[model samples]
Target: MSDHPFDVLAARALRVGAYLVRADDQGRLYDGIGLKPEHWRRAQTLLADAPEPWQKLLTSDPGDDRIILPNGGHILRLSSNRRGRHEHTILAVIEPCVCSKPLGQVLSESTEADSGCTNVTTPGQCNGCAAACLSDPITVECLLRCWYEDLFKLGRQESELTKLSQQLAETYEELNLLYRLGQELTVSGDPRCFVQSLCQDLLEVMSFRWVAVKLFDLPELSEQLAGMFVCEGTTQKTINEAEQAVEALAQMPQVHKPAVVLDIASQWGHLLPALGNSLLAYPLYKGETMYGLIVAIDKDPEAGDISSVDLKLVGSTASQLRIFLDNVTLYDQMHLMFLGTLEALTAAVDAKDRYTCGHSQRVALLSRQLAEALGLPPDRVERIHIAGLMHDVGKIGVPESVLCKAGKLTKEEYEIIKGHPEIGANIVKDIPHFDDIIPGVLYHHERYDGKGYPHGLAGEDIPMMGRLLALADSFDAMSSTRTYRAALPRERVLEEIQACAGSQFDPDLTPHFLSLDFSEYDGQVANHKAGDPGAQGVAA
Candidate 1:
């Protein structure tokens, strides 16, 4: 007896009419259990000529197969392995046959009506028929059909599993790409920056010779390109030539097609000499409005052929890009409209008094500079600028008699003047998108020692933006000529600001503010009342 456990088990099973056989690639049997020489020879011959139904079991890694012997006296269940230590082995169990005749003979002799043998007779009454026999051909045929159906169902299930796995893998890859794209693209508020980041992200996920985004003039598709953003793996000349070619192709009367992948050479053969041929063009649209076009030129050799999956990915990305671009456009329009309204308000404030004409604009310009000098962020600086322009908006509510009184005011008049900051804050407090600017508008007049303002916010207790604005507002007020006094000399103004740094201005911020060059603004302000369209100035 072999000491190997598998051999011992196989020997014991074979004695009970089951067997184990191992064969090599050459069809030569290598091991056997519980079989006479004659039986062993017969099994080899049978397997060598196994029917097509057994092909899957023989070729697959490890699985089961059932077969009826040619003589039809035995049915066998075979477990096969195409891998591991028993790589060439097929272990089988012999099951007693249901029919004496071969399966084929039984099937050939049976009819569909024979399948309903049980239903043909009443409960106790005997309906004599050949199908009622102990080894009925119909029963044998039905059993064989069921086994065959089970095998087919198993095969179909495996096929479906393979397809499902492939689809899942593709979905995972697509989601990963989208996640990366969102991280890279959504950080910028500028449309051009957004498009540039998009191009870079696409190149990371896919292989392309060049990627380009073209935004069109909206509400009208007549202009083919309003703006173009491109990232190129090839020469700029090649990209430029290809862009021109694509533009020309768009003008063709035959090119009224939807977004799709196309053979670049076939569509624009004349331009093939200057540009490589494989490309995809996708139109960006929302509803009936066509926004733009996104194009990829030449698939990278490493990326293989562009497939339906690639097209699907690109289309999904384009849809998201469309929404982002639309939002950016809308924001820009709203921003311009807001600026126009603020400019009109500033103009009205200037109209209240001739000497104070353009005072708000100067303050706004200086405040932005001071905010920058203090190392505030761009967004905060922009808020300060707007606040400076609107700081005196409450002056509109003040009686012109007091505004242009041309002499020192009584205590009550001075008290009313101080209320402008509170009134300015109240005026804009309800306007949407002005939340950050309101603090600066309300506290620009607040003294560093807590002595000034409609509110007594002082020292560090004042908002940082309020402190910066206070310095800017005071500097501009002292520099500009007024009905009561001529403008202070620059040196004298600087001396006074330095003298009052801790008392009236943020001492920590005053040095940085004083360090900035106001020469460019001084020149502009000097020319302001002489009639320039608008004062153009910048801080150094």
Candidate 2:
């Protein structure tokens, strides 16, 4: 019994006093209930003096086998653990002794002496003493009954162990689900993509019929993804019904208890999805911020109602999900704040020149439009938009007199003007996430034929942002009023842009810029004239 692995052999040890023992090494014992030193010494002696049939069981493969030994007035049971191993044997006894002499010893003494059996009405049948009942044939009806009772008790214990094993398995799978969700979180920061994947996985782990997760405050994602909808095993009507109920649920004081609407005739039955079972709706939130809600429909009937473990699993992940999205919201706010400050700085620069009051605003809008028209990704398009807004940020370094000059600039003034792109690039070069925007700010004035500006590399050597911004800047510059020239007509600007396709503009990217809608531009320009800031910054 050195290993003592009978923790789940819980019945016998709890009921009487089950002690672990090795069948072969009867002297050694383990996992024993309370027994004095004297009792332990007597226990070892009792096993050594056991009857032939009981002794044979010590070495035999009798799984769940039982043997009853007679003590003074009590009986002790030795039961096998059924594992066929020597160390897993169990000794169960309430109190092994009740009198000075054991029953087996008393019977042996009586069997040896005949004169004491004078009241024996029949052979081997004194009928008065307990020893007479086992006169010769030795039919112990009570011992047989004890054996059956032990067998039944052991069977019941096995059932309890099975239930415990199942609970452990459920816990293991829940941990696995958490691990996978953590992996998903590291790879994709998008909340919608995260929740969509979570719904699919939740169904598999919780054994639920369907799952619906919805976003509330994060509007950076699309409406289709943000709105509540069952991700699996449901229809649009059911999703719409859930969406309608969100306000009512949100208004009500929340209870952690699940609302089980299993009855088809229940009031919510018409709205809940999955005809098979129950519905569980849990709000995913942190303090006052309601990030989202997860609605689990029709939990498997066989799995029964939700347990604390189930709630904890969902709640733990929900808490993490909210944190991820909240961080993104904060990130977006910081980004917007930074962009706002940049707008203020450029508005001050434009303030130095009366004619170019809204020049940066129009260029920013058109550049963004052109990036989209050229099918650049969302992140790239955003960078280009910021680039356009700060395209002429270098003008802040130019003398106010030179910027507002009403005639063509002298050579020295033109040279001073040309240095603005380098000044603008240097201004923002060290700002985080502005690396790509630098080239656009520095090279917007560069031409396609390598004949333009500082470090004028030809063709595709120009950064993509620089290429796109060049086209947009030229378009806006030709159309907008400048200090030296009246705003050119729209058709003439188009003709001039086409004439300089390869020499001044990227021929491959030029067509995409030409096709963009200018209605927004027209409106912004009109707003500029009307003295409404619009996309334009504050007036000089």
State each model's C-alpha RMSD to the native: 12.1, 12.9
**Tens digit of per-residue lDDT, candidate 2, span 431-451:** 877887899999888889998
TM-score, candidate 2, is: 0.66
TM-score of each: 0.59, 0.66
Error of 1 at 113 (Å): 30
Instruction: Give the alpha carbon lDDT tens digit for every residue of 1-540 in model 1.
Output: 443434443443332223446555554567665455654655555555545344444554432345554533232333334445345645342322232444454333333223221111221112333322123323433354353345446667878999999788878777877776677554224456667777766666677777777665554322212455455466336556756765654554343334444476676677544545676667776676555667676777777887777677777778778767666656666766887789789878877777776778778888888888878777788788899888888887788898888889889988888888888888989888888888888888888999988788789999887888787778777877676777787788788899999999989989988887897567657656566344322211
Please, what is the whole-model Cα lDDT of each candidate in the order they appear?
0.64, 0.62
Model 2, 290: alpha-carbon shift in Å? 5.1
Q: Which number leads on TM-score?
A: 2
lDDT of 2: 0.62
How many clashing residue pairs are found in candidate 2?
Answer: 0
| Clashing pairs in model 1, backbone N/Cα/C closer than 3 A | none
C-alpha lDDT of candidate 1 relative to the true structure: 0.64
